[model samples]
Target: MKMRNLPPLNALKMFEAVARNSSFSLAAEELCITHSAVSHQIKLLESWMGVKLLQRHSHGATLTPAGQILFTTCVQLFNSLENCINDIQQKPINHGITLGAPSSFMANWLISRIESFEEKYPEIQIKLMTSNDFKLLENEQIDLQILSLNRQVQLKSDLVKIHLFKDKIGPVLSSEKAHNITQPSDLLTQTLLHTESNKNAWSFWATQHQVKLNEAKNQRYFDHLNLMLEAAANGLGIAIAPEILVEKQILNGQLIAPFGFTDSDAEFTLCLKQNCLKNSNLQTFIEWIQYQVSID
Candidate 1:
C-alpha cells in the first residue's frame, strides 16, 4: 500500500509503539490507553494501509514484511509529529525579549541597572546579546537594539530609530598612572590604548581636536568597549573612551581624563524593527528605557 493511505496520526502512533515493543499490554501501558484501544488502533492502521501491519501470536505481536516497511516509515512520521507538537507547545519567543547592545554599555552601564528593569517588568524574561558596534537595519536579528552613533541614519519604512543618550569621548588613564602626564603631548609618552570597536572613533576625535597621532602606535586592539575600559582601569594603558561610561571609575580614582573631551561621531540610539516595535512588551520596555536613560 502507498504510504499516503496511512491511518490517522493517533493510530499510526499506536502502530509504531506496538510494533517496536511487540507487546500489546506494554504498548497500552506506555500510551496510557487500554489494551483494547491499542489493538483497535493497530487494526485500523493495517486496514487503512491495505497491508498486514502485525503478526498475531498467542500473547504478543510481530511485524510482517509489509508491516516492517510501514512500521519503519511510521516511526519517522510519528517522531516528527511529536517533535512538531513539542516545539509548538513551547513559549512565544519563550516569553522573552532578545536585545542587542554594544559591549561597553553591557559591561559599564546596562548590566549595572538591569536588575531594576527585570524587577519592574517581571513578566518578561530579557535576553541580552552584545557586539562591538550596531548591525545594519537590514541584517539585524533582534527584538530591540541599542546603538551608539555619531550621525543620524536615514532608513526606510521598516526601521525606526530612537535617540537614547549622547556623551563625549576623551583619553582616560588611571590617575595613579598620571605621573609625567603633564600635557597632551605627554599622552604620546604613555601606553596608548584604542578600542577598535567604534568606527574611526579615535581618528574622528583626533581630527576634532587638531591632534595628529601616528596611527601606527595603536598597539592594543579590542573587540568590545568593556575590555578597553577594563584595560585602562587596570593600568595596562591609556584608552580613549566615553566620558559618561567611565564617570563612576573616575570618581573612584580608578581612571582619569588627561585631556579635554570631544564630541563623538554619533550618539547612543535604539534601533528597532517596526513590526516588533508594535509588540506590547517591547513598547513598554522602549518607553521605560527612554524614561530611565538621560537623553541629554
Candidate 2:
C-alpha cells in the first residue's frame, strides 16, 4: 500500500483546538502554547495544504469551507483514537464500567452518591457519560444507561430494565418568588423556564393537572435541565423539574416547589444488555446502584 503524506500532527492538533474553540488565543491557552506560536503553526499548515483554513477577525477565528471538512474528520478521528486507547487500557483488569445518563440526573442525584459507592467498592471504577439519548446504548459505547421514560412505554425485550424511581415533577422557583405564585394560573404572568431535552415537561405537568397553560406566556429555554434549574434558583423564571433533581435546592432554601411534586407518567429506570450482568464488576455496580435507590 502506498503511504499518503499527512500534515504535521502537532499543527493538526493546534488546528483542531483552534477550530473547536473558534479562537486562537483560547486554543493557545488550552494547549499551553503562545498565541503567536498557534498563528505560525496554522499558517504552516495552510501552506502545506495549499488552502486557507481559518479566517481571523477581531473577535476570533472562523473556519473556511475546507476547514469545516477537515475539522469534522479530525473530530471523528480523535474520538475513535480516544475510544481505542480506553479499550486498550481497560482490557487487562476490565474493572471499569461506563454508565450513560441524562446530565440533570448525573449532576443532581448520581454524583453526590457516587462517593459512597466508591468507598464501598474501591476496586471498581465508574465512568459517567452525560447524554439524554438512550440510543447510545445500541452503539455499545457504554455498558449501562439510566433512562427517564414514561411508565406506559413498553420496555425493549433485548435489554434488562429495572425501575429505579418514579419521576415526580412540579414547578419550582426561588423561594422569594414562590409567594407571588400562589396558584397555577399565576404562572401565566411570569417567565416560564424550559429545557431543550425535556421540552414537554411543563406541558405534561399542566395536562396532568388539567391546568390551562397559556401559550403566549413569557418563557425561556435552556439546553439542559440543570441550567434551567440554576436560572430558576436565581429568580429568572419558574421551571418544571423532577423532584429528585431539585431536592437539594429545595432543601437549601434556594428554591421552592410551590405546586409540590405529582407523579408523572415518566420514571427513572436502569438499563443494560441482558448478558452484561455476567461481568463481575458491572454486576457489582448494578447491585450497588439498585441498593442505593432502594434506600433513597
Candidate 3:
C-alpha cells in the first residue's frame, strides 16, 4: 500500500502520538523529544493537510473530528505493522525444531546430552524453550515438549505422546550431609527441601522405604526442581528429585542419594502436535530423545 500526497511518515507518527496522548508534553516524553518538537510535527502535519487536526486549550488538547478519524486509522495501521514484524522475527532461520520443556529438565538432563544430538544431526538445529504450559503446544508456539507426567495425561486428538522413562525418586543431599545419614530413619532429623509442585515427594519416598518422618525440623520449599537441587547441593537440606535428573551431580560428588532410588508413578514423555511428526527435524529429535532415555 502506498500513501500518495500524504504527510511525511515521521510527522504522521508524531501526530498520532500527540493526538492519542492529548498532550504535547506526554507525546514528547513517549517519543523522546522536547514538547516543542511535538508541536513542530503537529504544525507540519496540519500544513500538509491544510486543516487544523487538534484543538488546544489551556488545560489540554482534544482531537478535532479529522484527528479522531486519523487516530483510529493510525492505530490499526501500526498494530498491523507490529504483527507483521513479529511474524517475520519468529520465522526459523534454518531447518530446526523448537523443543519446550520444564526449566529443571532442561538444566539437569537435556543440557548435558544436547551436544550429542547436535553431533548426530548437524544440519538440524534444536531450539530449546522453557515451558510447562500445555496451552503453548496447543497454540503451535512450540514444536515439541519433554514433560514428566505425574498422572494420566489427556492429550488433544491431534497430539501424541512417546514414553521416555519413569522418574526415580529419592532423597538427595550434599556429600557432607549424607555422611551423617546411616539409615532411612536418620533423614527425619535433617531439614527437608520440597518442590512446591511435587508436595508428596517426601511422603512417597518414606512410604516406599517403610519409614515415617515426624514433622521435619527445618523446611524450605522451592517452586522449581533446579532450585531445590541447588539448595541440596549447598547443604541446605535433603531434596527429593528424580535420580536420573541428578545423576551427573551424584557422579561428580556434588550430591548423593543416601536413601537410594525407587520407581515412581511419574514418567517422562515427549509430546508433540500430530502434524510435527511429518517434519524430519522433529522426527529426528523424537527418536534421539528416545535413544538417550534408553541409555540413561
The candidate maximizing lDDT is 2
TM-score of 1: 0.63
Collision count for each candidate, in order: 4, 0, 0
Q: What tens digits encode model 1's per-residue C-alpha lDDT throughout 1-296?
A: 65664358788788877876678988999999899999988888777878777878987876554565455455444544544686798723455666777656654666546657788988886666654444633575457778776575675688788987775888888876788788666666667777666647666777776666673344577765556776888888888888767776788687888786777867888877787766988888888787778542
- Name the weakest run of 10 consecutive residues (lDDT summed) in model 3: 64-73
- Cα lDDT, model 3, residue 216: 63
Better of 1 and 3 by lDDT: 3
Which candidate, 1 or 3, has the higher TM-score? 3
Q: Note the residue pairs that clash in candidate 2.
A: none
TM-score, per-candidate, Cα-based? 0.63, 0.70, 0.67
Which candidate model has the greater lDDT, 2 or 3?
Answer: 2
Model 3 per-residue lDDT tens digits across residues 135-155 = 778887678887888757688
lDDT of each: 0.70, 0.81, 0.79
Candidate of highest TM-score: 2
Question: Which regions of candidate 2 fall more than 4 Å away from where they truly are?
Answer: 1-83, 86-93
Error of 2 at 250 (Å): 0.6
List model 2 lDDT by residue over 1-296, tens digit each: 99879999899999988986779999999999899999999999999999888889999987654675576557546755766887888854345787888756765787568768878987777666655666778777788899888878776777888889999999999987877877788877788999987888888888887777775368899876766877888889999999988888889797898889999888998888887858888888888988988888
Off-target runs (Cα >4 Å) in candidate 1 are: 1-93, 132-140, 215-218
* Worst lDDT 10-window in candidate 1: 129-138
